[model samples]
Structure formats: C-alpha cells, structure tokens
Target: MNTAVSQQPDAGVLLELDGIGISFGGLRAVDDLSFKIRRGEIVGLIGPNGAGKTTVFNMITGVYRPTDGRIRWHGRDITGLAPHRIAEAGIRRTFQTIRLFQDMTVLENVIAGQHLKMRQSWWQGLLNTPAQRREERELVEHAMEVLQKLDLADVAHEIATSLPYGAQRRVEMARTLVAKPELIILDEPAAGLNEQESAGLNDTIRAIRDAGITVILVEHDMSVVMNVTDNIVVINFGKKIAEGKPAEIRSNPLVIEAYLGQDDEEEDDPLLNAVHDQVNA
Candidate 1:
C-alpha cells in the first residue's frame, strides 16, 4: 500500500487516479492508468467499447475496488471506500443504462439519492411526527430544486418509467445531482439520443459545470465529445493512448487510429478534420 499524498500536480485538481488497474479473472480491464481532473472542468474519457471506461467509473464510484492503485479526492485516499462513502465524499455517477427507479415518482427518485444523509429514524417515520414531517418537506424541496435545475420540474409527479428515454436520462442525472457531489461521472449520457437530444444534453452538461461541479463525461459521439469537453483522455485495449485538450485530442493520430481500428466505418468529425489540418500546418 503506497500511502502517497493524494493531491495531483495541478493545484486545482479535485480527483486523481494514480497507477490504477483492475482485472476480471484473467482479463486486464484497465492497466496502470493515471489521470487528474481539475476542479470545475469537464473532461471526456473516450475509447473503443471494452476499453475499460465503465470499469474505471465503477472503481471510482466504489462499485469495485481496483485490483491495484490509488484513487484520491480532495487530497484524501479513497481507493477502496464503500459506494455510499464515496457518495458521501462528494462523488456521484449515472450509469450507462440510466438506472432510475421505475415505479417511483420522479421526485421520489431524486429524494432517494439523499439516503446517505438522512437523519431520521424508522421509528420517527412510523410515528409520523413533526420532525419526520419536516425532514420529508426538506427532502421534497431539495428534490424539486434538482428537478428545476434539470428542467424536469414539470414531470416531478410522473412515474419515472412513463417518461421518454431522454427524460429518464435527465432523472438519473437529477438523482446524482441531488446528492451535491463535487465530481459527477456520466457514462454514455448521449447513447440513445437523437441529434437534437444529444445537443440538448451538451447544453445541460455545460449548465452543470457552470454551476460549479467538475464533470467526467464518458461518451462515444465524436461531435459531442469534441465540442463540449475541455480535455479528453483516450484509451485503447485497457491502456492510455493519449491525453490533451479537446483540440489536441481531435487531431491525435493515436486516437484516430484507435477509433478507426475498432470500426472501419467510423466517421471523423469536421472539428477533428479542421484540427488535423492545423496540426499539419
């Protein structure tokens, strides 16, 4: 166990993944990956599927402990913290599948995220007393604030399962946001969206960053990833291929090669083409 100081070289870094690696049985899902995210920045993690992007997110959010390496948040080692402890430490995430409570009202789903911080006892709830009522009221208000931020207030009373896929995605984000995390990891946020929905998601992500939370976005849409992310870290076959600003990443040969090797028909974005031309100048 290497007990090094958790801070990154960047004075503003809020999260650092130092020498992180994880494996499943004999398969190396992620191998010796390291990166740092600055406070209030939006960073993209991109690669071919099975590049261990989701596994990285899972480890950071405490779904799995890394087979080796360190994870730090705010100068504290958090490598193997429990999921709820990670959440309490101000990190939260939404899954690739948009895991919303289907039977719950949208507001109820968001309030559930406050589970780690709830102070009332089950006995208090059963008694239906003033303190429990006050807690419930506060929880509802907090849930509503989250809904309003995501512009989902109109559907607050609706069943989460009844919403469109895009709306369901918003609810997942809302649930995460209601927890007030300093770092939010979104996995494939634009996966099922149409062009318009993807664009809307871009706007929402920017709004979230502007509200002062750092964002780590895992996405495959080059156009969206290239346009919205401040920086990108590209991985291939469970290894880091490159890390740089969006403009730099857009033209990186290794990144292009990784994407091309994975899918021959993958389209290159106009921004990437423009950046490539500039890099050659």
Candidate 2:
C-alpha cells in the first residue's frame, strides 16, 4: 500500500516490479509492492514468516500472476509469461526445497538446465544427427565448466543426491548457472545449511554476482542477509516496510520492531539481540 519505496530509478536496472500485488481468495499475499534490481547486484528480500517474500518470487517467475501491476525485464513487460517462457527469457530460480534430479548425475542435472538454450530439436536428438552430437558434446563441456566454477566438478559423475547437503546446494546453483540467466532468484538458499556451510554459501553468492548475474535473494537468515547483500528490501504483512543498504536496514527501528515485536521481553530475545550484535559489529 506504500508507494514511497516503490520506485527508485537506476540506469541499468535488469528487473523492475512496478506496483505488483497478488491475492489468494480474501488474503492479499503481496500488496502493491515495488522494487528494482540493478544488474550484477545481490539484493535481499527479507521479512518475518509469511511476509510475502516467496510470493514476490512466484510472481516474478510466473508461478503466480500478479493481481495488479507489471513486471519488467530490461524494460520489457513480461508479466504473466509462463514459467518456462520466463526461464527462456533469462530468469532462473532455485527453490527453498532442493529440486535436483535425485537419480541423475550431478553433471546431467546441470546439463538439463540448458534445455532452453539447446538448438537441437527432439527429432534431431532422436535420430542422433551429427549436429546433435556436436551440440551434446558442447553441452557437456559447458555444464562441466559451470560445475568447475562452483567447485562441484570433482563430483560431476556422482549421483546428485549422494553428495553432502552443502555440495548438493552447490549442484542446484550449478544447474541454475548453466541456464545463463540475467537474473537468478534464490529462495532461502541457506535454509538447511549450518553456520560453516552458510559462510561458504555467502562466498558462492558473491561469486554469482561477480559472474554478472543479478540476484534476488529471499532469505530468513539475518546473518547471511546482512553480510552478503548489497541492498535489502524489508516487508511485513504484504507491504514494503523498509529498503536500504545492509547498514541502514540493520539500524532501522522499523525493521527491528517488525522482527522483535513491541514487547519488553521480545527486546531482549536472542534473535533480536543477535541482530543488534551483527549490525553493530
């Protein structure tokens, strides 16, 4: 409902959500939200549970159409495009739940993500034409290169699900990278990772931005969000509450109140206290 933080023009914004909103029956999951993600920056979308974070991702990826407003990719309106079409348009995402092909090898799973970019048709693939063979070779090489970038090439042939949980997370990232998207949306990427694993993941995310991909990171882990993100947009009850750099967000009274509530007991709670410690450190 607040348009104050809705728009801030940037010269090279890769993705723009202009007054986006969505509802399910009587509940408004996201209400007239707006934000812009500049190319090559890691922007964190953070909030308390049920804060419409994932709902925004769903709308951007076309998993759910916005009830109002437009989603633009490089200034082109792409609202309501099918999910596959969105992927083909150079927007890819990883889920909160790992979605790797359990039976497939790590390399195979990454290669599968390149389907939209593959030029060979089904018929050509069925016949195993020379061109198809060549393309397949190239695909393997490309997938391996992505795996190498993410430090997962050593386990390239292992069953995807057989790796350690952190490594498996890297596999999912490798899979998304193979698609060569302009924007990558990760939903709670550090969900199951321990502290050490989360630290490593933070490096991997920085690497992703260094690779020239803009990232919209939806995460609940305040430490990861605060440490890794270049900018943060905070929301609550389906509305934008705050948006700024990590330092500003860390000190914002609105953000502190949103997460800690207004009770004296809550002010001294572990979660809020940890947040204060991180922000001040």
Candidate achieving the largest TM-score: 2
lDDT top scorer: 2
Check candidate 1 and list the clashing pairs. none
Q: What lDDT does the true structure give each of the candidates?
A: 0.85, 0.88
Q: List the residue pairs that clash in candidate 2.
A: none
> On residues 149-251, what C-alpha lDDT tens digit does candidate 2 reach at each position?
8998899999999998989999999899999999899998987888899899988999898888989998767788888899999999889999999989988
Off by over 4 Å in 1: 1-10, 263-281
Give me the displacement of residue 234 in model 1, in angstroms. 0.6
TM-score of each: 0.90, 0.92
Task: Mark the regions of model 2 whose C-alpha exceeds 4 Å error after superposition.
Answer: 1-10, 262-281
The backbone clash count of each candidate, in order, is 0, 0
Superposed Cα deviation of residue 113, candidate 1 (Å): 1.5
> For residues 40-88, could you state the per-residue lDDT of candidate 1 as single tens digits?
8999998776788999999999999998889888778888888988888
